[model samples]
Target: MEEERGPIECRVRVPATTTNFGPGFDAFGAALRLYNWTTLRVGNGGSAESLPPMVQEAAEAFGKAVGEPIPSFECAISGEVPCARGLGSSATVRVGVLVGLNELRGRPLSRGRLVALASALEGHPDNVAAAVLGGFTISTDDGQTRVALGSQLEFVAFIPDMEMETEWARSVVAQTVSLQDAVWNLQRASRIAAAICLRRYEELSGLFEDRWHEPARVKRIAAWEEMRRTAYGAGAIGFYLSGAGSTLMALAVGRGGEVATALTRVAAKRGLKGICRRIQAENRGAKAWLRRPSRRLA
Candidate 1:
């Protein structure tokens, strides 16, 4: 039998993700350098209060799945991952909670089980898979996921002054798509995988266009056309809506600063207010570690 230990403390950090990447739709996602942090510890005489709703729910689900009497936990969260900007902020929170709890329970759950649990909680796996597995991920409807690493490209995200709820953005997407558009996106999605593998960054510009969700969703963003044009003019080779987006992201190598400045300047001129930041893809996903309490048996 395993010996008892001191109070367990777990800290988890999960990266933000931008899903779809123009044409992959609900299948593709990339982890970003931006992150959300959550710390969890076993506690006494208190409810799981003050935690994010997703975190609280995840804790309950995990406890039930493990069939263990779960101890009350205190959770604290802090990060720059903005909510409702299509950045997978909720995924970070959910993934962090699951990971932290798993560690506190001595990590009986496998990574695959964790992925499945997180995906189930998310109702979709793209963002959760990327947050859990890191790098770039493609999730299939058959409950399978493929991941690839190595993206040297930098990203410039132009955040808008307002927020767009994911439900509303999802509701706006078309229910039907033509076969031609489906084939078009499928070919490019395949090519994108190859391009990222071969480090063929120049081939991405053409691949970034989509005939499906982007067309329907673009109408919601004011000055979308102009923003796309300006992003390219500012030396971004490829640009796309970040997830469901109140944020637009441009892909570049050495031109992130230039692209970010141009995006902000153009948005300001168009009376849209928000900040722009240059960030890179994070290959490492969420990490959780146990910090044991100092030994003092007084």
Candidate 2:
């Protein structure tokens, strides 16, 4: 094949999300206040000079998976999520890359298809489902969408410093959960899904307390107790594991200055370095802006 370089760029928006919302494991998910912005370009491209490592890592992974390397591209990846902090960092990058690539390829893949593809690679649906579909999503195995809760809520995430590999966190759980614990998750997940679909944001608080996973993982994360205590003291409505552990997330009253300050103090005192984000519960999913070819209409 001859060398070719007809450059094109695509813009994409993807949001942060919390999975396992206390009780729902690999089942319940919620979109949060941060987002990943990126543009994929083919051929000669400009520079960001400060692309996040997650972004670079994600691009390389995408290239390997797709059987084609990421062509010369100008990509700017910036977001509030700290690396390895359980705030859907990987999902956002994956969605952003897939969105850009699809637009470049003349929009060949459907969003649903792309969602399944990303979820398969991510090894779970909690994060990717929220990033793609937005709002709340419930997926078991892969094909089943038992519940799809379109966005409807207000949330402010108190992200704490600390990191844990998802695999390491996963290793903490019991191979078999107690029968009662299983039933408890089932009930809360059902209620949470119903509340999301009905737009009953107020009821979400009850649904966020889990009986299956967070307790187990919190044991491994050093800052778990202090983070939770401080968040509740900060007037958070509810809280749960964003994904696995270490990256403590809380659903606070609002994404306002006071709430942020309270969480910041807590993080500082605890020595966990990270930022606070006023994440909007968005269900708009992945949207792309196409860069039209520069033309002369003289």
Candidate 3:
């Protein structure tokens, strides 16, 4: 008789991503050191019906992509990325489950293929591209381009005690823009991508100006103007909405501490309770590994 196969457990660590840096709306994203760890245990008699909707979707997609039926599995998620905060938290979960399932299936898909699947699930490529490839990613329909960010660069994120749903945020944005505004945003977005790729940090200044999305969304945020002014005054190179925002991010070279402090203080004065964190770019992206099954006493 053939021996029975034991249960397999796969764990994945997916980095948090900040997308839509300035005018690169839905096109730009970078991975941060903050992460969410997800574990998938297969052959444990776990039912797919018990899984969250997002996880189930990911698993179903993975099965379809690989041309195999995915076994029922149990999933556990733990991490620091907060949901509905424009921090790519949902992307982390989707990517984590996909990667975890792939690992358990003998890695039938390539990383690029996984990225494509993830982008589809995310409804955009920016966050999923960054989460999969790490560093800084510029995602266009043509493909994705990545650039390594130096450790000196700091991302100071001010996460308010509020949640802004991505769906609602997208609903507020206008579908039309003036010719001048379109040109302006295109120029800045292109320059910002080049600056990061060429390591021209100085050129990044003034290039984060956006004529789309932020204008409509900022109105919902309390003391938005003051937050931007304070961040700049405290040594931020560029400050902008992280994604669809309740959390704002500021780029600083070495002045992250000052910027974080200023933003925190200003938020408090505005009666907005929140936390500030200084994080660096995570170049390693998401990683998955199979856990060795434990043996029981005979």
Residue runs of model 2 more than 4 Å from their true location after superposition: 1-5, 44-76, 143-152, 253-262, 268-272, 292-298
How far residue 228's Cα lies from its native spot in candidate 2, in Å, is 3.0
Which residue pairs in candidate 3 collide?
none
Question: lDDT of model 3 at residue 116?
Answer: 93
The TM-scores, one per candidate, come to 0.91, 0.78, 0.96
Residues 27-134 of candidate 2: C-alpha lDDT, one tens digit per residue? 667666577776666554444344565555555555555667655456656666666778788888888877777677666666776677677668887788778777
Model 3 C-alpha lDDT per residue in residues 182-227, reported as the tens digit of each score: 9999999989989899988877877787898999898888788999
Write down the TM-score for model 2: 0.78
For model 3, what is the alpha-carbon lDDT of residue 62?
95
Instruction: List candidate 1 segments past 4 Å from native.
Output: 1-6, 142-151, 293-298
In TM-score terms, candidate 1 sits at 0.91
lDDT of 3: 0.90
Sort order, TM-score high to low: 3, 1, 2
How much is the lDDT of residue 177 in candidate 1? 86
Candidate 1, 143-251: lDDT as tens digits: 5455555555898898887787888889988888899988998998888877776678878876889888888777878888899999999889888988888789899
lDDT of 2 at 150: 34
